[model samples]
Target: MSVTDRPVPSHDRIARAAFPRRRVLQAGLAAAAGAAVLQTTAPAEAAMRREGWIRSRIARMSVEQQVGQLFVMRVYGNDATASDNRNMNEYGVASPAEIVAKYHLGGVIYFAWADNLPTPAAGARLSNGLQRAALAAPGKVAVPLTISTDQETGIVARMPDPATVFPGAMALGAGRDPELTHDTYEITGAELRAVGVNNDYAPLGDVNVNPANPVIGVRSFSADPALVAELLVAGVNGLQSQQVSATAKHFPGHGDTDVDSHTGFPVIHHTREEWETIDAPPFRAAVEAGIDAIMTAHINVPALDPSGDPATLSKPIITDILRGELGFTGVVVTDSLGMAGVREKYGDAEVAIRAVEAGVDQLLNTPAADVQYNAVLDAVRSGRISRRRLDESLVRILGMKYDRGLHRDPFVDESAVDEIVGNATHKARAQEIADQTITLLRDDADLVPLPAGEVLVTGYGDTTTVNLAASLSDHGHPAQAFVTGSSPSQTLINSAVTRSAAAAVTVVLTYGADTNTAQQQLVQALRDAGRKVVVVAVRNPYDIAGLGDTPTYLATYSWLSVSTEALAKVLAGEIPAAGRLPVSIPSQADPDTELFGFGAGMDN
Candidate 1:
């Protein structure tokens, strides 16, 4: 029979079947037998009731269905169209509906491709269709799926337009206001929930200590563990308050490594003491703050586990360290298993089995869900992994789903998506965060609050640069733009220099100039040409050291439109540079020498 043709089970029926009165009575009687001796604890009785329900549900599930509950597969949101369906089927990728119906997946994660719907209404319709499929799957105990996305506000946002874009974590940290951080995440959660995403992989707790760290640069809150912890907890509260699960990610810290775990395993040699001091504090705080989930990092910490296994597949790390030492009772989810860090070492099947045995409750983004599911089922049948162990994770997963109220109403209101997403208030709050987070690192020439005169804006012609020019012009500064590539050709630089000669002040925008020599050279050439240059590191603050004697420097931390507007306001003296550096800036001559400390920002 087709999955769609199957009869759907009512929520009450599933609930009653999951927690049978007979079993509940049996457990209650046993508890009551000891009630006089133990003084009848309501909490204990409630726990027993929950355990009975989970056990009854597992007892009713087929092996395949039970194993499927452990996997959260990635699905395309664009699969509602015939063309997308054809392409997905040709590529052997199942539609979101098909995956939920066939595999009975525990959850679905929306990627950028899936989330590129025409509007919030379209996204809501797609999400509702997927949930309906899960509900219609042929099963006695059909549970609703947990829908999720990487809606981390700035660069990592998966949901397309109509979702307000806030500054990244580093910029939030620069703002140095926990209340603002909470409100930002609360809005992020509300928008995601409006579009039917229940889980958010965000508030990255990594304390980015290594300036050269490629992947986690601006995604992290700060280099200081204490500050990151304070802000991370606020972020957690905000998301949970909005009825979305917040995941404190890259467990035990992925911030110090130079290698990208997406491609390879980065080894951190920090001892237990070192880790406790630097890498573990944010996670510890997250556990205490009641973070819903903790995503494991693919990097290997030798001190934590001598087996050289990454935390995603290490029992000692996930179970002993996070669960035991930190006392985190929430779900433990794996980073994507498709990443080379895990895939290259262990095949999909082995990785799934190992992750389960290592105490990971959810297997995320596996290369092939069917293969992993079958492999886990085979392990269970062969006694390689006990069904009891499987049940442990299943209980937690189901408990979270129930707690999220998915069973009662998994679908979102399609009309509400448009109403809640990117509303006026959210956009204003985003602009406010951007305005407050502009850090003035260097202003030796007192070039800011420029006297009424013509201004030259030159950059790679990115969105941020275009917005900056428009914002300046709007603020009555006659601004002319000199556009260039991210790595501008000499001709472009020369042209910009010639254009700058006519303006009272030259504003050169840079992205990753600390690493990109071309960006550094362009700034140097403008300086050498004797243009009064004010450099803004739009992406990374590390560019300050690379600009080579620029008279003025500022850190916008991101290139979002709001950030660009804020930059214009700060430059025009309409808004004070109130933000501080979240991470220290290293000297160009000596990497060890601190050129600017973490709280260093000046306001005129």
Candidate 2:
């Protein structure tokens, strides 16, 4: 039976009743009698070969429905009554299926927590629910949506329960091997897809040009352009291997800026040549390697696009440099419009209108989705944004969806997910990568694998060196651990100096960051004690500048559990340290190491 002749399903009636805004708009999208609007045409970029049912359905959508596919709206996770109750209570956009149909939402980007799904059986159940929501569309296939999430490891933990947490970008950066980076992303992508996630906005390609930068911190892989590029390639290949598209982010460059774009405009002060040589290399490499998506940052690059608008809506940057100069043909997407960098400057509709005019293909986390839609429609009506441009972007977006076979029967295989979700092979890969990436900066006198010594451990932040100290103690060595939330307190320093005076060794883990006021003080503290100081950088490799030559130095580059275990193994001489410095270490006097040469290494 034809779709119209078939009785209206309960879901259609409910969605139509709940979202009159959508029903009235899409009532005319069908080819049947009583249709109020233009019938759907073949999806702008609908898969050229797939004859799947969903593909056929997408091919039938009208222009408006095709345009709808460019949007990716955020949704809170549900399926568990407790989760549903909590997230739904916080955000009103509950009942994802109805919301999908009502809003004409192309896809649902769920902010999820899966820590509760401990067993394979439990994970499959939840993955199925999310997949159902992703495939939900009232009476249409041209309206097929793309589900996405920020699964960038430690930077943003999705599920603290049910899922294993891998050390994030910083940890991978410390390992300094593209292959390890590859395995890291592969594992992350596999787990995400197994849980029904289709897009991972990850593998942050920023060069991290500033050490004091609060947010990016160790999140960046390295300061070296070449290393970052190779890592980006590995990350892309790994994610795509699992069919989870990874997005390389912060287009022009977000590394040099010290300001957090989420709260303010981050100014990238490098010249055109500087950007091309360093900050832009990784992104360029990712694009060349056929990365599926590119997300623009909200930061301002004065030299590249001085129009004062964020790259998200800047034509010169997105169209002129990104599309024109760089030769990137992939989808050009915008970061969240809700971020302060964009919202503080442009109104929601205006932001949406400009992004399209600037050649953006997808809109992520737009606050007023309908407002942006209406504004784009108005621009089309006013001849402000050319219909050709709109169609062009829509075609690119649709083409990707079609390639993914989203046009026909887009649901993920629920039963098959259990086998792939947190698979043993993936975890083993992570462990192997971790084993190879840990760096031993200064292993003087082969002092490591110490026969026996009373060791005193201290560092920045709240995370104590209790674990490291315990790891040392198991070898029949006496050890003590002390921790503070802030950078080393005066009392902690005094206590550490006194304790070190009588100890065989002192191992300090700095939890705060690379550039700090403690560099000079740390050196003085160790000199006063005349102790063998072993400083392990748990944040950024460049942070080791604080240690000087006072004692031994090691940079784990991240505080993730894997890297920690790796460091423990290195101290125990379980594996030879093979990780080279992915980025340069700043000179002892220069605490900010913005430019570090890649492949800097030393043996244990």
Q: Which of the numbered candidates is closest to the native, going by highest lDDT?
A: 1
Write one digit per residue (lDDT tens) for candidate 2, span 1-604: 0011112123233233223453444344353433432333344223234434444544676545655666776644455323344335434454545445545656566564424234544544554554464455445653345667787776575643435556667667666555677778777777776666667787788887566676676677777666567777778888878777778987877777778889998778889999988787788778777787888999888898888888888899999988898788877778887788887788999998888888888888777766877687777778897767866776666655655545554555667765676567766666677777666666664566553668776665444377667766664567777664345667767776877787787777775534565544664677666777777777667665554554566777666666666677777667766666655666656555422345555666
Per-residue alpha-carbon lDDT of model 1 for 427-457, expressed as tens digits?
A: 9988988888988877788888776788988
lDDT of each: 0.81, 0.67
Q: What are the TM-scores, per candidate, against the unseen true structure?
A: 0.90, 0.81
Error of 2 at 578 (Å): 1.7
